[model samples]
Target: RRRGGGGGVETAADFARTAPRAGYLHKLGTNVRQYKRRFFVLRPSTHLYYFLGPNDAEPRGCIELDGGGVSAVRELETMPDGRFRFEISLGGDGGEGDAGGMDASFASANDDGGGGRDGGGPRRIVLEARSAECGREWIDSLRSESLPYVRAELESSRSEADELRARCAALEARVEEMRLVERDRDGAV
Candidate 1:
C-alpha cells in the first residue's frame, strides 16, 4: 500500500519487466456480479475496469486503486483510425475521488479516522452508473471475463498491424515498378 504518486516509485520499464503474479488469473470468477462484489473484499490490489459511457467518443473507461488513498480515472476516446486514445491523469489531492462518496454507505466506511485499507486513510473509488442494468453489466465483465478478452483483442490488433504493413510494402514495390516502366518508355521516345 503506497501513498502518493511518488510512493509507488517503480519506473515504467521496471513495471513492464515484472512478471504477472501466480494465481492472478485464476482468482477471477465466471459471473460479472460476483466479480464486482469481490472488489469490496480486496485487501490490497489494483484493477482496471472498462465502462461504456454515453456515446462513441466515450466507449471505454477505467477505475484503478492501488491499496492506498490514491486512485485514478481514465476515459477512452475512440479515434477516427479505429483505435482508442486514453485521456488519463491522476486526480490531485483526491478531488475526483469525491464522486464515489455520494453513496451514503461509503462515508460510513471512512467514518473512522483511518480508511478501510491497513494504516491508510479514506479508501476512495470512482462510481458512475446511469442505470441499474448498465452498472451491473459493467461490474460483472470487469470482475469476471474482461481481462482475458482485452488481452486477446490486443494480440489480434498487433497481428492486424503486421498484416497491414506487409500489404503497404507490396503496394510500394508495385508503384516503384510502374515508375521504372514509365522511365523506360520516355527513354525510347
Candidate 2:
C-alpha cells in the first residue's frame, strides 16, 4: 500500500525516476542572487534568465537542472544581432529527464528561419526583453557605475558612524571617572 494514501510508498529515487508529467515549452529561469527579486525564464534549451525592469539593462544568467533541483551556475551570452546562445551539458546517461528535451523547452530562442537548429532542434524559448541595452555592455555598466556608487556611499556612512560611536564611548568613560572622584571626596568628609 502507498504510505500516504492513494498508492504505495515512494522514495526520493522513485520520484527522480519518474518523467516530467508534461512538457513545458519556453519555461523561463530565474535566480534571487544575480537578478535580485526579478524572476524570468529564458529559452528552455538555453534556460536563459533575463532580468527585466527599467534598471535591468541586460539579461542576467541562466539556470540548469542538475538533477532533481535547479542550479543557477552557467551564464548566457547574446550575439551581435541581439540573439542569444546558451551551451551547457547534461552529465551522465541521456535519459528521461536529461537535457535532450531542452530544445523544446526554449523554443523562443530560435530564429524565424529555423536555420540554427543545432543537433536536436531550435531552442524552446527566447525570453526577449521589452526594452534592453546591448547584452554584455549593459552588465558592464552596472559594475562600473551602480555597484561602485552604492559601495562608496555605504563606506562613507560607516566611517562617520564609527567615529561618532568612539566619541560617545570616550565621554562615558570620563563621566564614570568623575563620579568615582566625587565619591572618594564625600567619604573623606
Per-prediction tally of clashes: 1, 20
Specify the poorest-scoring 10-residue window by lDDT in model 2.
Answer: 19-28
- Candidate 1 achieves a global lDDT of 0.34
Could you give the C-alpha RMSD of every candidate to the true structure, in order shown?
17.2, 14.9
Q: Write the per-residue lDDT of candidate 2 for residues 96-167, one digit (tens) a residue.
A: 122224334432331121112247632322222222343333223222233334467789999999999999
The lDDT of each candidate is 0.34, 0.35
Number of clashes found in candidate 1: 1
Q: Could you tell me the lDDT of residue 119 within candidate 2?
A: 75
TM-scores, all models, native as reference? 0.34, 0.26
Q: Which portions of model 1 miss their true places by more than 4 Å? A: 5-133, 136-145
- Candidate closest to the true structure, highest TM-score: 1
